[model samples]
Target: MEGLTAQAAIVEAPGGEFTLAAVTIDPPGPEQVRVAIHACGVCHTDMVMRDGGLPIPFPVVLGHEGAGVVEAVGSAVEGIAPGDHVLLSFHSCGRCTACGDHQPGYCDEFVPRNFLGARTVGEGDIRRDGSAVGGNIFGQSAFATSALAHADNVVPIDPALPLALLAPLGCGIQTGAGTVMETLRLQPGQSIAVFGGGAVGLAAVMAARILGASRIAVLDLHPARLDLARDLGATETADAIERLSGPFDHIVDTTGVPALVERAIDLLAPRGTLALVGAYPPGGAISIDPAAVMSVGRRVVGVVEGGIDPRRFIPRLIDHYRAGELPLEKLVRTYRFAEIERAFAASSEGSVVKPVLVMPAVS
Candidate 1:
């Protein structure tokens, strides 16, 4: 296999605007596959990386929630072949203990592999004018029309489904829905309060409704999102967490706001659980009363990628979507790949829940 040229959205520096330019993509490594991306979802984490919230190298291509068709595979890859439809997820080292236990989200090399923008320091696969450009972000960096991904992060899916609609299942949707279905496992008749009625929170609302949760409350600053939350199965909606009466069986905080997290801990019912799914900047901290947690046996757990194996969980999510149980259409808005800036603006302004970039067809 030889290198291929593709157009990608690149950020030249911290807090930089994305520039669409032609770049050279390397062929698949022994344990990798190459994908011709059809669509990629814009996530808050992508904005976080853009604004220097993460310590990734610049001049990087960053898009993790991608869905596409496999174009090629390496010698060591199996079970996936050219023309297979697939969705990309976070990268994980298959040999790690967490991965051995089927929990790849907690892989030991997660930070270095997913955030550092390369497989190792100073080595990048994508290049421009012979200059190494940061790639391998989340192991796919599918912002490009093509991406190289680890075999572990690529899950083959049915070709009949719309890739644009299912793009977000790789990240935000999975995180939100998985937090409820896998992490908290909210039982029937239980109650849950989800903070931040964005894609993640709304996905949780849908999952909670599917699980038959008695009370599903969503809190968000935007009135429109709150209304959408109600329409998506949130039994209640509020602009502030305090306004919603709690003592809830489960609480999920997707805002990454320290103060809100602290407040949420106080509202957990006895022996209840709290799942933290948001990203906070490095060194972000919260003050918690140990006694408050100990007295009620409240549990707080940090979740990544909904604490799920995408290979398994993504298929289940597709099943729900097929049944019309998970209405992804309500949460997604598509844009042409060139409309990247407008997509970001829509996401930042809360005008769109999930903005998916549809790549131009290959000639």
Candidate 2:
């Protein structure tokens, strides 16, 4: 069968710059769909992978937070059709026990399905110069004008909403909001301290406020991010956690810094929980006082993808946005496809909370 050729950003080596190139994408499989990507969000995870934080193979295409319109559907796909708008998320093996329990974040095949840079069953669906290329990073190598996505990993959204603005909801935004509303389950009138004022931290702040948290504190090194946090509903903002008194009902550490994790543990109130949602470097470790844990009845948990099913959670986030609660657009900044490097630079410098790459509209 004939293939579709499109523009994509490819990294040829660890810590290499992303270069634009023409790549060929095969037609959808029996259970896949083709998306004409409109926009994709720049994420810290992509940065990490680019810098060799993960053992990703070189010459790979890496992007996950994608939103676009359906171009075609596989013979077996259902409920999704051409002309529908959708957001792409992480992939999971539906047969795994974790996936059966609705916790695809912990799916047994997660590493193979999401981190391997190729689909589980096929050699790969992307090629360059008649050679195979990595395509299915997170089931949607969305740094291109088009991508092939599994039916299960695509979530339909309203076409009326800005596609570029909705891109981040697939990962970063959902991870933050879900950590606050789903993982920690912060109740109204409770307290929470988020130890980072970036996209994830600010998302938590919005969710905490929506849940009526009486006191929501945010700590970040950047004054601008702290100010943005305040505007996003943080009741307290500080340059350091030391400036904020905690003993909070819940403490969330979105910074993987070992020192910050220790401090977050110390700030948790008796019987309170500390949720860790940050990505740590390989083999990194943190020390905690075991006696304090026993005496205070504290709970420490590591959260993955906010412990939420994207199909259920993304819609709720959109609903919150519609209700004027999420205000996710405040954190977004758009860049043209050719400006992907500039977008990466802004994200690396902490200049933009979320940088979305907008592809040229396909006519």
Candidate 3:
């Protein structure tokens, strides 16, 4: 393989220390694939990992929304080869109940393994040398210039597409689309209230549109996001979703802020459903009015990666992107890899919807 001059962002300490440095990547072991990352979407979860929300191994590589080309593959890997374009998702054990059922997003061992940043394969831990660093962040420490991901988890893409856009498709977009289509199963004309018009919220808006929701309302405080929300397909835009008073048939909450979650529950109409698609810090909990939920026969559900099977979802996304539907281009704003900290700042401030950090081309 070409000389691997991989770069990575290291979380040396919680909230206070994020360091970008050169790192050496090892060759893929059995069943692993090495990917030369072209783009990685700066996701909130990565930031949370830096800020110590998920208690990952220190100096961990933190990114899950990465798209790139396969540079190498291990002996046991099949159906994937060098030069294949791929996107990585949250890790899963293939034999688990959820994974066997094609819902790896629901794998029972998902949280501990993916969050702890442990290796899904290989003899010993891979790191930046000497220090105890963890790889396998989501089974693909994709924040680096390259990553070694489990081959089974890599979804191939046509090289004709830009890796920059495909990055977000891995998690954010898939989660939003899958939540409405697979998890909630919105009938032809049911209403959906989408809370928090960030990347995921706006994505839900588009996905609900694709599902033909009768009424799709986007709720968020940011005017710009609301504008984007409307562009995506939200029939109505609301700054305060709770102002609607009665709940709609479904609520998709992208804001893990407990207060907003509580408000979402309040807005549910009888027999309404709520889906929490965002990440809350460890120990984060929302207070619920059990009687209110019971009286209305309401249900609150959690969705991970939009409850999607990435292999199927990614290809569908590619088709949608080519078909003039999905409208994903409107969601992304790109930045250079060196500007990742700036990109993260813009994302955290809600100044940009989805700030993708593009890597420099290798010679």
Candidate 3 Cα outliers beyond 4 Å, as residue runs: 1-3, 120-125, 129-132
Off by over 4 Å in 1: 120-124
lDDT of each: 0.92, 0.89, 0.82
Ranking by lDDT: 1, 2, 3
Tens digit of per-residue lDDT, candidate 1, span 185-264:
99999999999989999999999999999999999999999999999998888897769898899999999888899999
Q: Cα lDDT for residue 218, model 3?
A: 87
Clashes of 2: 0
Model 3 CA lDDT for position 296: 72
**Model 2: lDDT to the true structure:** 0.89
- Candidate 3, residues 244-279, lDDT tens digits: the string is 545588999888878888878777778889998878
lDDT of each residue in 1-363, candidate 2, tens digit only: 468999999999889999999999888888888999999999999999888888676798888999999988888889999999999999888888888888788888888778787465542388899998776888889999999898888999999988999899999999899999998999999999998887888889999999999999998999999999999988998897789897899988888888888878778899999898888878988899898888989999988888888988999999998899988789999999999999999998999999999999897
Relative to the unseen true structure, what is the C-alpha lDDT of residue 213 in candidate 3, on a scale of 0 to 100?
86
